[model samples]
Target: MFDYSKLPIRNVLCLDMKSFFASVEAVERGLDPMETLLVVVANKNRKGSVVLAASPKMKELYGIKTGSRFFEIPVNNKQIHIVESRMALYVNYASKVIQILEKFAPYEAIDVYSIDESWICTDGTEKLFGNRWEVARKIRETIYEETGLPSCIGIGPNKFLAKVILDIEAKKNGIAECKYKDVEDKLWPQKVEAIWGIGKRMQKNLNRMGIFKVGELATTPLNKLKERFGVMGEQLYWHSWGVDLSPVIQDWEFEEEQKSISTGITLMSDYGGEDTEIVILELCEEIGLRLRQSFLQCKTVYLGIEYSKDIGGGFGHSHTMNDYSCISNQIYKECISLFRKYYQGFPVRKVSVAVSNLQNFDNLQLKLFDEENQRDLSLSFALDEVKNKYGKHSIFKGVSLFKNATAKERANKIGGHNK
Candidate 1:
């Protein structure tokens, strides 16, 4: 019962590259990106390392998919090629792809969602580029021709529709469109899970309510949905109608401010209790610096420890405070408390920490005991300036000299994996 006549009808294209990482690797090796069987892993030497991407043929023929471990990949499959991740090379290719996209739309109209996907608004470009369909086809062809990255294009009147169509339909057809007029026919028949935002847990809840299809959820009372999912339920209802008012302006930086700051590391080797605490202290500094970098303070701190596979079981716990903070030592105190309370003393292979329930640093109130707090804040600010001007490792923690320290190793990596 929403007013369809009043909604803006813009031509948005959500573009996704097919098996981006694996395809890029295949093309780099002079293999047919479409026909080749390849898998990208962080460390091929580590048998348990997860696969980042798998080529189409590998998925179709061998059932090997992204997230499958190295050992899970069939060694008997002589056709498969295993390659280590090269994030810098892939990012360079993505930048070149961005240059190609700029030909059709300006930077403000483009939103790069991730390493492999983007949304471009071609609202008024139909005058110069023929039509939206033709523009999509041309862009798809131009990308494959110049960079050898096969792409799928999903056309819609808004960003959400474009993304869903790209994820659900264009993935099968290479290029497809879902209009507001066609939402009933195009989006309703799919399983609830197939809709972009409805994950397994939500789908399960909907199933309990006898809502197995998109149409059922759409038709359900707004109050019912809001009761179950709060504001998100309202969003789902509008999304079900293929409605989105957001612009494609790379708004992610400004629109989604940091709600939390965190850092985690999987130790190359198992760590004992004392060594784990030292690593946690180092991680606290990293997290606190990130909070300061973003000008955020957090009221809740989270700690997670994954025991070595041989030991089994892991624990995740959190501590919330009335006072918001972004100081490293204060954060370290909470993390250590949580660690001691729940840690089973098993050999730990991985450790993680996060601070959330955020507030701006500008809003942080000065404490009654301002003398020590000011000194700590001043020292941290000075260290941040030094690191920003020089290099990250320009200054190092004394504990970094400790045997179990991962700060130096992580500084040299990209997203905790080899660069």
Candidate 2:
């Protein structure tokens, strides 16, 4: 581990959104972020729907995770206001943020680490943007003005320390740049989990080894870590000391491949019995609409629910079509069937639909027993075209027509009630 306590660390800036999805929704909806305990959830009423983001105050009260729900909040539990996520809107804001970064820093030398985090190489732009600290502040203010998102930036000698300082201590100190001068007294006191990419599982593993904090991780033996975790251990050890040699690379291609597109919503209230079936039906239609829009066929569809308050604890059930399909009805029917098998009478707070192992619809073989199957496929494609041109929900299936149903409730939450 590289110790920067005495040395001056510079030429690195880590820019991160405070609460990306929730902030975008708040700005769009004209909601006051500081006063509200807002959460970006898949479904407003669902109990254990994934909590994409929340305000800082909410974090202090609830310590929410990605899959936490509104009802789980212990303090002012009734104060939880769930907002349904808008992927398109978030992407739009994220693009603007990237544009601001490009205007302030070299595009290629900037690394977009996540949806809300990016690392910019400030080595060359110091003169133009001013000293490292001034440049970071300018970037932060520019992003805030352009996108209305609060960002805490950290500057260090390398990307690793920059990210560590930003992730760990910047918010507490109200500092823009976290350099070597502040490492021992500032960064080293924080918990190990504060380091980016050091999640719960890794934290647990580290804890078992008697490594509890940043200081402990810094002092742990490299040979022991390497023996236990291989290359990842080595990286983690180096990360503890804020030693990151990885260059900020531009043109970083995202790894997601879209064979089928799907979304989920957690209800503000839990549902069982027939209501659960209705939610499943709504998810099927949503997935079906998305599938046709992308011009893909999926042989597998899954319905997942998280009834637990804790993260990473849930059961998912999936069904695969032996014959394979692009037809929405087929996918929907199979999805419902799978749900029936998995429901087990447990109250569901969240519902999700996903289609995987996709194939091009043009290559789909026509069925011999069902003459209408091919016709149904064409109709689905036509409907997809209409929805794509007019906007989603302009046309919806009859099954989802019920007013104030789970689908509508979740949509309102995601669409945001204000804007």
Candidate 3:
């Protein structure tokens, strides 16, 4: 039997910005996102465009939320506001929100998970912050006062429990804490999919074994799960019991590990022919930019294509590079080769590019007869300098002039949405 007392218990806080995009839109207009009935869409002109964010009122009253299509929004309603996304503005505000969190936990204790979520360790701050629940409220209130954005907080002993509690209970209750004693009543009733690590595909597998509730999964034989799903299956069983040993990795500590890096985009219209190359190059370039920022290079690339769901099929494949490289041109070359190999002639609505098996520049292995590779590395380094000092668009390649190039349009976007 696993000894609960042996687990490493740290007070981790999972913070989520409620309807972040819509909230930023409302704040920019001097309205409260919690009170406003608003939905932020990627594009106002495209009815099929995805909803970037929806305000709390809009979600509760209209059942419209993120991923809701623009066409589904209630038009002609004077009370409801449907605004186009301004991703740059949201990112700017997100930074300000971070400033507020830094007041409690130093930057080393905070892990910025996404544009709107973070996990913070408050393990040793009881004297300074009073208690965990109080600190959570303070963060929630401080963000609202500083940036006019509402936030939810989940407190737990580790990252997984904190994140899952925020997703299931904190967002609605405002703030929720999951101590070890609260596990059965607070965590068990939720469906498997509602938990943080489990997804739709995993839900189906668990259902096949009649494991519907979190409670059942918590008590199932660990060996059976390990036999079924292997290492990940073991993780599934542990996370089901609200146990997580992962640390909250600070932004300053990102370079130590080589997990993965990826970039993807959903096009406004289905692309065909040469246009696909233009989009793929832009995504690879974006992925390369991120890799270079981390001072890392990758030895594997993955490409994913989503034919419109209406058409019924999509494809994804990965290839390991013969030589590790972080040059945008090199990554693009590999992706184009993959496109040629895997792409079938279908209207493509989305594209994804990923680079993995990362290594820091200090540890990179150079070739003996590799002048061209050296030049590529030097140029990529120079480009990263300009991008960091100026903006991402301050430097551009000839390929960006392609007719379907979207890099210029998205230069100011945070995650493919306009700003």
* Predicted candidate 1 versus true structure: per-residue lDDT over 18-103, tens digit per residue: 99999999999999988998999988889999999999999898888888989988877788899998887888899989999999
Candidate 2: Cα lDDT at 377: 72
Per-residue lDDT of candidate 3, residues 110-141 (tens digit) = 98999999998987788998688889988888
Prediction 2 global C-alpha lDDT: 0.73
> Between the candidate structures 1 and 3, which one is better when assessed by TM-score?
1
Could you tell me the lDDT of residue 313 within candidate 3?
A: 80
Cα lDDT of model 2 by residue, 1-419, tens digit: 35456644458888888878777777877776555677887656666556777877788777875667656655356776667777778877888999998987777778888778888887767668898888888887898787778888877888877877776666655445555655666667878887778889999999999998888887889999999999999998776666666766556576666755677776656666477677777777777776666666788888787763533345687777787676767877887887777666766777788889887554435444266787887687788778778866677666566643665544544343312
**Candidate 2, superposed: residue stretches over 4 Å from native:** 1-10, 17-95, 106-116, 144-150, 172-186, 199-208, 226-232, 245-247, 252-262, 305-317, 341-347, 363-370, 415-419
Question: Against the correct fold, how does model 1 do in TM-score?
Answer: 0.80
Q: Which has the better lDDT: candidate 1, or candidate 2?
A: 1
Pairs in steric clash, model 3: 86-419, 87-418, 87-419
The 10-residue segment of model 1 with minimum total lDDT is 361-370
| Model 3's TM-score against the true structure | 0.79
Q: Evaluate residue 101 in candidate 1 and report its C-alpha lDDT on the 0 to 100 scale.
A: 94
RMSD of 1: 4.3
Candidate number with the higher lDDT (1 or 3): 1
